[model samples]
Target chain A: MSQHYRTLTANSSSYFVLVLALTALALFGLAAAHYMESEGHWITGMNNQIVWGLPHVFAISLILSASGALNVASMASLFGKTEYSAWSRFSGLLAISLLMGGLLVLVLDLGRPDRLIVAITHYNFKSIFAWNIFLYTGFIVLVAIYLWFLFERKMNQYVKVAGLFAFGWRFILTAGTGSIFGFIVARQFYHSAMMIPLFIVLSLSLGTSVFILVTQIVGRLSGSFMKQEISFSLLRLLGLLLALEGFLICAFYLTGLYSAARYDVVLFVLINGGIYTFLFWAGQIVIGTVVPLGLIFLAKAQLNSSIRLVSATVSKMIGSFCLLYVMVIAGQSYPQLMFPGKQIRSTFFDGVVVHYAPSWPELALGMGGVAVVGIIILVVTRVLPFLPVEEQRAQSSQ
Target chain B: MSGSSENLGSVDLKRRKFMVTMVASMAGAGFNLVELAMAKTSLEAESKLVRWGLLIDTEKCGVGCNACVSACNTEHNLEDHGRPETDAQWIRKLDLVDEQTSHVHSLPMLCQHCEHPPCVDVCPTGASFRRDDGIVLVDKHTCIGCRYCMIACPYKARSFIHENLTNQRSWSPRGKGVVESCTFCTHRVDTGRIPACVEACHAEGGGAMTFGDMVNPESEISHRLKSEPSRQIREDLKLNTGVRYQNV
Candidate 1:
């Protein structure tokens, strides 16, 4: 049976309010970025010690999730899961929207946001960051073309090829993101080959969680429904991804714990680094990983599937943020090991774990990126027939 | 003396007049007399033959001697913003106490100017670069202030400018939102002078610092490095840092 999609009516008062709210938040975020740039980064909590702060955590999470958002579309086209084909168009749109949101944060957070043109024009092949610029833009273009193929009846023949290409590019995109930290040999926390796989899995977990949340919220608001089986299947996929994410995170820290050189940093994050330690165990490992896993696998029989799914996805989202916060911010906060077996002191914050408290503007800028994603999805669904509609159910609802 | 005067008087009048006229014109047009005297002008461009480096004898570096740091600040016009964490420190005094032995070592730490700089490797815009003379410098024009170089530098030698400023030195040319670090006093080095830190260390502190050409075997730095035991800070990375330390 041919699946049908429909444009959102967008006549509801609630939808209008949401669109207005998201737009306001996005604009506020832009204003925050402007203030930070005009006055200087000192207004923010970021110092020389922690160069990248909250903005990085938010930006990286969205970017990784963007790739993962396309997983449903990949499943339909690449893995031949026909049940998932209905969700493909929405998935493609969500992927692009999420990427645009993430890119906005990353670019605006730059010291010279005005030199964005320079970043685009210049190419440093050895730098993973340069490679990511290409990967990010290329993924958007490829996914758009894939979406085009899915939309046009005449172009249906080559959808698989486009899907395959996009699928491959997203892996590289996520790898490039992970390698941003992995390639930093100077830091005790990074410079491991395992960063690539860990990031890829993270993208999968975060992306799937986001897709599930969006799928349900949009479905309910648009007065459409999916087969409970399909919803259950998506939850199962997220559960598997979370398990993989947990395993990789453990392996990453365990390997570092084995090395005496990496022991201090590991101990700091896992045990006694205060806020960082708490975020890792309570926010990242327990809430982000284990709780979600338990809720999905164990609580499924007793709880409503929708409630279980939402709780798990929301928990995972919180956990993902914690994980990134600990990884990016805490990773830099730890002092560089200049002298291996000596206590070194300097005015430049050497030999001490630097303190960073995210300023208001930084928080505003990060939240704004999330808002941008929401506004994009809201506007796009209204203008275009991106929403999946079950034909029989649509007729019954009308 | 009379015979020498008679020989000088016998010299061609026109040649002497032409030489005087040329020197006066060049001087009027803002020529550096020092550059002329050195014979190898700055316009000749830096050469690979001259690898500028420093050798610091940590044993001679006295505790609480802020002369080197003070000189570096004065030279670079590094103003104190009262926020040490965010302030631009071109050079700072470092105190290292052995965990096992309790022996304290005091030294001044700054950019090492590595032969293969990680900052240059990781710079997305090619802003961070190493000159032919082995003086690593950041071309601020291309620096997006990404701080990747700051992350890549093992010594934590780089500083990101965090606030707006006025009265920046014409020679230094620093601004907010860009990364800066020890340039090995490139402005002074280009004009045939030692770095401010080294000069101050020699004159006011413990005479711990030596600045010279590492490539020149006849130079004091090369002689000292070959004759005595000197080591790079992180030898395992094999960055081949131009700066070396002795008796740490």
Candidate 2:
């Protein structure tokens, strides 16, 4: 609870080069967004049929994980876990940067990105998309306030209230993100109320996975380590959350498949849907759910070992990305049913499984978001104290 | 007492005016509301009083005939630039084959212009909106091109302009980086003329499409729907589409 934090000197050539590289990547993303905005979305692989592509996948995953990142702060302040309070500031910082990264991608992907102000000014209470604009903005502000409370010793008492607000806000934010797809009645795959909970579980697992990775990086860079016991506890919690997420996904898939109306979609997702099937089973089921579960469920003797922690963390990270990719991309590629009793043939690719191969620009922009987040973290950690409490070192010391 | 009495007099006058309006409306209730409106103003403005709709007799739609699609393309200045995947299809014949019986039914699919449009419901900027006369449209000025409406549309009727567009019709203003769909030939419909597709169908394809006001029971589409038993595509969604199909 009495942890004293300090900023990194970040004087090493390698560290400077890493920051420079990430900044370049972020700038490249901005350039790509500008090019697409000026030229058209046709430059990207997104067409009239598969309107959303890699941009959406990356954006949603980042945003959901951003909300999850705040779990550390929430547990610390909101749930009265004083030990985690040491890391709450770091959580708040990561959460803000992640949200900014995700939001930049989403805004740039808009067909009329120039008229972004219109989106904010207009109110469509019925639309989940409209609600999300507020949710996302509210989260950033809440994170800022939570971090402020952490930094300002006098206002530490209000940290709990801010964390509570942030906790509730993020719940709605992630739920709204899921509902964007779920409330879509036109599609065979989405429209279940259960998607809300499914996404929440997804956010928790992915969030924790990202947190574990950040913690490791923080420990390495700052030379102040998270206690072995705390790391173990966090990993175990991640494993439990992943298991819950796995159950929810399975239950959701089965429930959706059971409906006669959705039988075709189920077949497409599980059987005939080529890339979609691969993504669902191989990418999501095996890599994401299974590997993490396997790593986390290791025997107590192995679990206590440092090697086990690193392996588990790495697998969990891979798993989160895989599941999110499947959830976003494959979920969209499947054809929507316009006619229940009839097979359709059309030039507009109606009533057919659509394939989405994201072009170079799309992939660049997607990774740009990650680079932006990384750059922010790097710069912030160097300028401000975001690491665990350690002996203060002057800016001259590397 | 005098001030109170004057106030009572104004209140009495308001009540008297309300009674007069109520009595007048009640009297005109015997006549069609559209007819009674002749006293107020000319029907020159396309009033929401009429809900325009289309009744398509799918049985009469000729196989391999793309008269309607061709007409829609020309009418809206929708050019095909060798990219069928990205081009906007204002209307196209959906060649539907019954999976079990192998029975085939072909019907032109376009924007349904539902009474409760999902596109309108999901648009973040409220740009996707339904006109009072039952025509759904996107206000390009306000549309941020987010394409959430496309995600919400049940019929897959919407299209996004993937490439930079040029040579657009003055009547149908379109541009790149914005979502667009069939406006049901609003320019022609506003002028009290049938949609280009309906005219095309009557001329070249087949006498399959009937366009008129669904709100008017005496209108051809209204009468046809009532007599022939037509159905809206995805009727389960309860969108109450302005477009209907018969003998599918």
lDDT of 2 by residue, A1-398 (tens): 37788776656777778788888898888899989988888778888878888888899889988999888888998777876777888899989988999998999888888888888788888888999999999999989998998899899888889999999999999899989988889877777777899888888778887887877666666665666667778888988998888889878888878887777787777888787778778777887778767877755685545666677767766666666666666666777787777889888887787777888888889889999998899889888987865422321243
TM-score of chain B of 1: 0.85
Query: Could you say which candidate leads in TM-score?
Result: 1
TM-score for chain A, prediction 1: 0.98
Stretches of candidate 1 off by over 4 Å are: A391-398, B1-44
Local accuracy of candidate 1 as per-residue lDDT tens digits, A1-398: 67778887757888888889998999999999999899989899999899999988899999999999999999999999998898899899999999999999999998888988878887677888888899999999999999999999999999999999999999999999999899887898986777899999999989999998987777666765555677778888999998888889989999999987678998999988999999999999899988999998888589877888889999999999999999998889998888889998888888999999999999899999999999988888888888767833843564
Model 2: CA > 4 A from native: A299-307, A390-398, B1-44
* lDDT of residue A104 for candidate 1: 93
CA shift at A41, candidate 2, in angstroms?
Answer: 1.5
Q: What is the interface RMSD of each candidate, in Å?
A: 0.9, 1.1
lDDT (tens digit, per residue) of candidate 2 on B75-183: 9888997877788888988888898998887889899989999999999888899887899999988888888888789888999987787888998999888889999
